[model samples]
Target chain A: MTEKIVVAYDGSENAHDAVNFALSIAKAAGADLIVAHVLEWSPYSFLTKTEVEERHKRRKEELERADKAIVSPLLQEIQSSGVNVEVMVKYGHIAETLLAIVKDTGASQLILGRTGQSSLTSRLFGSVAGSLAQVAPVPVTIVP
Target chain B: MYNKIKAPVLGALASCALAAPAAASNIDEAVNEVFANSTGWFVNFIFSPFPGTTFPWIVAWLVVAATIFTVYFGLIQLRGFKHSIELVRGDYSDPNDAGEVSHFQALATALSGTVGLGNIAGVAVAVGIGGPGATFWMILAGLMGMASKFTECTLGVKYRNEYADGTVSGGPMYYITKGFAERGLPGGKPLAILFAIFCILGSFGGGNMFQANQAHAQLTNVFGDFPGWITGVVFATIVFLVIVGGLKSIASVTEKVVPFMGVLYVGTALIIIAMNADKIGWAFGQIFDGAFTGLGVAGGLAGALIQGFKRAAFSNEAGVGSAAIAHSAVRTSEPVTEGYVSLLEPFIDTVVICTMTALVIIITGQLVIDPATGLYVLNESGSIQTVGGNSGVALTSAAFSSAFGWFRYVLVVAVLLFAFSTMISWSYYGLKAWTFLFGENKVSDLSFKLIFCLFVWIGAAASLGPVIDFSDASIFAMAVVNIIGLYFLMPIVKRELTSYNARRKTGEIKKFK
Candidate 1:
């Protein structure tokens, strides 16, 4: 039976290792890979839908840049190894969005970098990885 | 009818006034009796006991050591306060920094670890025994403690290890060893080894056992006849699950729960105080009077001061290096930023929450025990009993119940939440300390967690006299070892501060978003 693994990615070197780790496991277990990039917006500030959409567009470009710089390379390596991969990009709360993606994709496992580029407030409040592990419906592997 | 109403009210007030001297006498007698009966047990089982009371003595020693570090650092806590905030606000925040959590999250997680049952129960005990004067001393100690926290946390960040994988691990053990090694000290390894041993011991008793014991008591008390073993098992199991997941899981739970619970408890206290607005003035008056006069109890002003200082020290745990372990993981280039945020911890824990507890006890006029007879008369038994042999929870409960009818339920909920959250956070502290001593491997981790969980059950069901006393001592002991490290390492902290400030001034560092 094939398993599904969701890997949380940012363009950091650590995220690259986590992506590779996820790919290795995906290959070994013959699992499906869902690469997730969460686009965060400050909850305290107000912005119009048009403004949010504009920001989202900018964030999409950033994600695309990361995909080219990091994620795409990792996916290429995995595909060359004959592993199936699917990429996901969403704009919302990191933890909530990751958990939702896991549920939506029926991911049996989650692989994430130990730390990433979240704002200090979110980090202090906790990371998407920490929060997801606490309440997520599956096992989480924090690649460090 | 006016006479009838006046007479009853007067009678009630008179009885309340009369009850104090009596309760005081009773407590003295009980203390003497317990001391006499428990002396042998204390000597045979606790003093030279397996882990021993030497650990707590170490904490007291840490307090002394921290005091020295504060002086050596030239009272950096005061000078660094404004700068600490600037660091948090990203005046010096570095987004590309190589650490696990943000500076704010690091402080929050660390604050979550320290700001628990100590704030609620410890304050009540101080006010109940030390009189209202204790609040003043507690506030003073809290202020001084900020400096201590600043020193230790600054060192925590400065000496932190940014793992090849980007996971950060740092604390007293890392700094004590790493700092000494850098200095070319001959006994760096030996001293670091000693500190690690003490930290592991302190963590097990103070962080792990004490928290679990308190949580188990509160849970059993609220749920009713659930059997303490059940509470212990459930708590231990949950702790195992989370701890098995390591620091990230612990951080996540603390980040969410700490703020939510802090708000919930503090908000409730605010409402109660507002309702008792008339007595608020009197409460303040009592605090000032008791603090200065040492009135209503024997042993005079000195006794009151000791109680106040003791409670404040115990409550915020500012000087204690245990909190630094949690704070060390914060991702920041500037160490002082975390130090400044750390200052707010004691303020919130002791100044705000503790003051609320003290006021609740004082305004309700419940601090008195008869000097002659020494018995509590308000309740029929004339004696207050505590589960697990520690009086912290019972004392707080009585104070809350007296303030609002049926709000005792609120207190029970608050206590359980406070204790439970505290236990989880402490588990992380102990685990880190354990890894420092035993090596960071799965075997070492599992063994420590297993022992820690067992103690939770023991803490819940066993007599508290030895356990709590020992735990309190252990907590203070960590401060002793940590303060020593901080003292020797103060020069480094000063250098870091100077460098950070210089960067900020020159506009070399930009604000982090």
Candidate 2:
């Protein structure tokens, strides 16, 4: 069985670099490349009863929007590489969801973008890469 | 009997009573009479005097509720105490969770209302009339009240509603209606409506009027006597400014203010207790001795028990369902976690803060305890005056001042801040209920606020008896409806609790911290 590589894609320029890096890593290792997109979501627990209903509607719209606007096109563009690839889109903490996917898919390595968030924000919140590096079950490669 | 009222104020009140009786007096007294008489029906029914004792059976309602919950939940208040701390510390909080505030903030806002005059004056009054033994019962009731708080807040969060604007509405109203609907039970709407009415009335009475009334009392003590309406106007203006219109952002700022005043008040109690460290044991001895014996008061043990439970119920308001409004806004997926966190409120308000106030009063020896009769000596005016011959805030003032002369000034500020913040919180609480009853619109909202402000003026300028009576009546009345709802919805809460407990045990509920 071929080893698997996971790419954390968000449609940002650095995400393109990450997909390319994962694609190359998959080729060199003769592995399958899995593109994973995490749509940011809150727990939705704060919403009022009325808001909760509307939030569900918005959340569906958001999932569809994320797939159509970013994930679908990105997956199609990457498919031209002609390597065996799969795409997964989910919602939750970006790094956590990506890590979970890596574990579930038995991926050997994970590649994500560096500095998608603003410098000040990443400094304050800590970079997602910085966090996943410490917790990921598999090795993480943050492509700049 | 009327000595606490100044002679001049008495003259003025008498004149107002005399002048109003013919024309406006009948209408005023009659309206008061209707509410006074009718609410009493409900009040008397709930608080019927216990047979062979002066204590009301209604106080037993909360006591029983607390006890049943304590046992039913396997003493969750104790078992969950450590987790309560962790939950509050944000160990289980996910920032992305749907909530308008954090655990600490919601607790602070709710605490802002509860940790006010009740801790300062209500405790003093209980100890004075019920003796130190009242302190024992008060502590017991507060501990037990924790379980009541847990049950209500869990239901509160479970039944809360989140709106599209990211604002959430919770508390007893939502729980009563939604919980019942979910359970396929009837009477949820009517019970919710009754609770809203009492809540709004309570907001106007205890939250608005009583606050201004006491603030005026303390103001006069510090700054010398001025017409209370003047202080009322100042307080009303501040309340209106903070409560109405924009700058709605001050809520977060005010949340911090409550804990500050609480710490200040509790810190003062600690210092005084330390100064009289030797008296600490003696104070506890008095408390224990008095509790069972009622210290020779009219009702004895029963009387002390009554006063303790009644005042603790009044102060912490654990079962009254107000704190659920605040706690429901907390950012946690597990509603039961909010329950665990909110139970800490009564523990802090009554058990810690109120107990400190009680201990300070006891250790300071400010209470004029009559050893011969085991009764507290009434002031020269033949009125109930415990601290330095002044009841209410003055009594608490005297207890603190006995240790540090300057502490009274601090006490005065603390009282004022406590009263002020309590009014602010109650304004929001009342507005929520008002909107629930009268439709949430600018007109109803403004009108309710306008009426609330008017009461601030009326509260300052009026006598304490009727206002405080209404306050006590309405607040306790809220308990009547709220406790009823709690009974119906408790099974649902149990389901939530059991599920959360199982998930927590299995580590499915991961702690971020």
* Candidate that scores best on DockQ: 2
Residue lDDT tens for model 2, B228-338: 656666776666655563344454455555677778778878988888888888888888888887666546788788888988988999899888876776545678988
Q: How do the residues A35-105 of candidate 2 rate in per-residue lDDT, one tens digit apiece?
A: 88887653422222222223445655677888899888887887878789998877776777888788888
Please name the candidate that would achieve the greatest TM-score relative to the true structure.
2
lDDT of 1 by residue, A1-144 (tens): 578999998767887889889888988888888888766633323221112213324544666776687667767666776778888866556787788788878889989987754578666787666787799889999887
DockQ of each: 0.03, 0.06
Candidate 1 error regions (>4 Å)? A1-38, A41-144, B1-75, B94-100, B220-227, B245-255, B369-390
Predictions in order: lDDT? 0.65, 0.77
For residue B270, give model 1's deviation from the true position in Å. Answer: 1.7
How far residue B219's Cα lies from its native spot in candidate 1, in Å, is: 4.0
The DockQ score of candidate 2 comes to: 0.06
